[model samples]
Target: MRKIERSRMMPIALYRYNLALPLAPFQWNMSQNHDFIQSAQRTISLERDSVDALLPRIGADFTLACELLLNCKGRVVVVGMGKSGHIGRKIAATLASTGTPSFFVHPAEASHGDMGMITKDDLVLALSNSGSTAEIVTLLPLIKRLGITLVSMTGNPESPLAKAAAVNLDASVEHEACSLNLAPTSSTTVSLVLGDALAIALLEARGFTAEDFAFSHPGGALGRRLLLKVENVMHVGEELPQVSPGTSLSGALLEMTRKGLGMTIILGDDGRLAGVFTDGDLRRTLDKGLDVRQVTIDQVMTVHGKTVRPDMLAAEALKIMDDHKINVLVVVDGNDRPVGVLHVHDLTRAGVI
Candidate 1:
């Protein structure tokens, strides 16, 4: 056998193997967690800066855009391409909810038959960051031919889309949050903020009310709070917990348990609201070593219980509960007689919480 030097032979083989192989990506000397955090911070900072840049540009063009939409006989027909299209949809939704009738149509889809959605009475609000997006540009002539007012939001004011628009709302941003400065990061955020600004400005100009907003968002929690009346959430009929002042504390407890409200409204002999007896009163009474069977509810009940009207908003009832740090409210009519009993649980269950 030939005398073999294993270490020298292995070194030659290893050097040749290393020369043929590429470096592993995971072996790169960098902290991934640190990079992630740094990237997040940089993106947020860039986007925030872009949003700040929009504040100063709320000028005459913005006013003209508002005016055109406000005067339009038909809905606002919003058009955009790509990322601009996504932001346009949200803008339309916000406008629609805030009392200004609006809807979005994709520029590409508009070219392919969706253009019929736009009419002479409609006001077209087009979004194109570059102001030269071919799809949106193609619809400009059709929009103008139909005598529809065109409002353009873009970073490039000198571009064709801006030049063609009746009003150009400049949405130019300093830079993008993307490391390559090409992705729609800061620009999209600025566009969204500007759209919200427009919606809110028009909302205020039209004197939009919470009740109006509630009507638009009927299935939402805000609607339940604004539209659901006190009577709607209050326990009425036999579900209401009521007792006479002459009733014993033990009797009130039975009423509370029976009604599942943790409290009972106390009525005077005249049938008016005399007071309220609650589980908290039971605790205090117990702490005082009072006999539940011996004491009348009038002795242990809370005098001048918080009350609400049947017509009051459940939100108002919630506010009263929060202000008083109490969980129950007695609904009374003009005669001061208990019409219903409202519990915090009822408000919670009704989605008014």
Candidate 2:
């Protein structure tokens, strides 16, 4: 059976209940896989256009907002209610990780006591779909009184929150993707895009590079690819399964079994990288002659083997494998010595693939 079939059935009420009818066979489950993506892509493209339209309007005030955030002594403080609150959290997180010190503050929580999280040295961004969310609008006066610069993102530019803002980036959208036109959809996408534009643009202006981004997201895919050194995850010491280049093919096979990596690194004279022998190589070797005792690793090892530096990112290693369409590689040092080997499976296990 295909992977799509193994998915649990969708709720009858949430979708058309007639399992016997109506869809391409492969789409029996996960109808949303392509359908929803197509729908969402429409909304994403629309929002992308909205942000693109915004570029021409990057006036003195927009520059001013950027300058204010750039000069802030503290983090960028984001606040909102409802769906906007959820989007606010993502924006805050993106900003914080991309070299801007930032975090989300729920307006409701702030009204009670969390208002203390905002300070005069901070730049505050407020989000509201209606420009009049009571929880958010109610707290606006206090934020203004605290002497922090206020930036509001709302679909309704004429609303109170926009009126209160020092700079209001128009996030207005024509309509939501929701059937009733009531739920947040396109509007939230535009808001999120705006927040991302701000964060990344500010990140660039501050000279924040990929290394800076890696520091904030060491656990993320790109961060792992760019920041994780081979030493941090490579097998070493007694865990290594390696053999000298002259070892018999059977001996190399034994090393592969003991190491459980489906392959073994072959070292050269003076302990340097020489070549590699894999299970695949053994199979090819057997095709010529089944006598392992008569063969040596040098007779079958791959002389021009793929290799990576110990200091390279795990992500880069995955890319090297993918670009070359290979399955395994040896980790080498500055002197071209095999320190370890990485397989496609290793990247999967390390969450780098």
Candidate 3:
């Protein structure tokens, strides 16, 4: 081991030798481990199929679960332990971001005092690999008596937790991804898939729109989608780099460069939008050898420029800019006067892209 570790090429040579020599018991078991993953793939495909088959089979209990959640006046509380707890937290987040108010509560902590987070108007979704986890089972009676709706996710349908739930979604699979078929691998996958199904179904049933989703997820991609109004990130007032329509092309060029936006908005005498001047216009002007000092900006600026309303979405503005093949846009008010300027680079810096 020391000789191989110190040599530059010897390590690679030894590694190849070790791999070539491994045909005994250890290698035989190693090959089995690699092939066993095929079973894992089968498990995921089966779980996906189960989720697809589940929608139609929702039946009355499905309506009951939705009603239980829809009628909930308080938050939906999720509880679990171990691997199930991890999946529960994600489910809780999905529910919260998709219009349902929800959060995760650890069963151990619930027995201590966190149970206070759950109210009679709420529903409890508990996950347990065996429906008989002592920590989870102990809380069942208290949850049931509190008049909180109980839903359980478990691989064993007849387990206590499964029997306790007002509705039980069967997550049963043939075996696990564990070599000894003891680990929770396949079961965890099924649980996650089931939670996603529930969250999406409820999202659609409640008519939850992207605008609604943006309200809850105001910190990440979701928040970016909702919280960014055009005006919030636009260059307003003097930063707009604007010029009077009668200004000389030289004055427009000075305004564009001074503002550093590569463009200038041209306003009519009535403070209404008239046109736009940019470096592109400067190029066209130079093609005719027009002297910047003598030419009027009004004669060369592109008239009736494309504009966006101040109330439009930042994402929508990006689409318009992309479609027009322009990198900057003028924001206009109801009077059609330039109110602000938006640069594509500004949106990129703000993570609006």
Candidate 4:
């Protein structure tokens, strides 16, 4: 028993010594923290300067490049190597989605059987920081043989690729954001920004609108907001909860409950929209000590409440609801007849919310 107690105490003493060890090496000092922040800020500043330098280079060459792309009958074929390849893929995707047909073809793979993807009608956009990538330079002959138009984005304007291209947009940077000044940091950022500028320019030139963009991104929320109309999601025909203006408030409540839309439309004798009786109106009536069984719906109903046209975008209807602090809207025809009812819950279910 004495030996066991001594062994346990020995382990406990070792554990306490280990726990007491200083963690200062792992903790950042004020000077080290300042260095970290300065490193990030320096990278941002260098990249910003690189992009600013590109502004002056956007001259006749830039205009010619856009013209080539705008007039191309076939898709824009983008080619690049290394980091430029990644940027090329992104640029191609942006162009394709913005009404410019484009796709990325790896320079190395193009020399393989993938060169078949290029056609005489297509315009080739090549990216290389050094502008002399062996794979790209080797394909220049074949590109020319195909009679395809070539545009190049490169740092060295005098390099083989740039000299071969119909127009070269300079993407040079004085220094890289990397501490060693060797990584493709600033250069890649300039290329990306230049690509975005090209895409936006082409978009505006082609008169691309939000509706056109929605067609390209049909799976996203923006597409739903822009493409879906009021008639598409509204409750119409028999699903519409409505009663005559002479309906008792209690009868209107029954209709609202049966329709499960939290509101009921009150039509006039001429069968047009006279007013709307909603849950809020019921609350206001009760607050005034009015009897639901005795009061008529027209006495409490809101006259000519917010209405939307069947052709209006659901997003517009959502805005009206938000501005008025209401949750429902009545869809009406030109004659002010209630044709359908729209509830906020319906919009939420349709993902317009």
lDDT of each: 0.89, 0.81, 0.82, 0.93
Candidate 2: what lDDT?
A: 0.81
TM-score of structure candidate 3 = 0.83
**Which residue segments of model 3 deviate by more than 4 Å?**
1-57
Using TM-score as the measure, which candidate wins?
4
Task: Report residue 268 deviation for candidate 2 (angstroms).
Answer: 2.8
lDDT of 3 by residue, 1-353 (tens): 22323345454545544453335554333453466568768767755664565456556665677777777788888888999999999999999989889999999999999888888888898889788999999998998889888988787879999999988777766666565777677778778887887888889989999888888878897578567978988999778788886789888888888999999988888888899987777888899988889889999999968899878989999899899898888899998888998889988877888
Clashes of 4: 0
* Clash count list over all predictions: 0, 1, 0, 0
Per-residue accuracy of model 4 over 115-172 as CA lDDT, tens digit each: 9998999999999999999999999999998899999999999999999999999999
User: In lDDT terms, which candidate is top?
Assistant: 4
Model 1 spans with C-alpha error above 4 angstroms: 1-46, 248-258, 286-294
lDDT of 4: 0.93
Candidate number that wins on lDDT, 2 or 3: 3
lDDT, candidate 1, at 91 = 96
Off by over 4 Å in 2: 1-56, 81-87, 128-145, 154-165, 170-193, 207-227, 323-325
How well does candidate 3 score on lDDT at residue 284? 82
Q: Model 4 clash pairs?
A: none
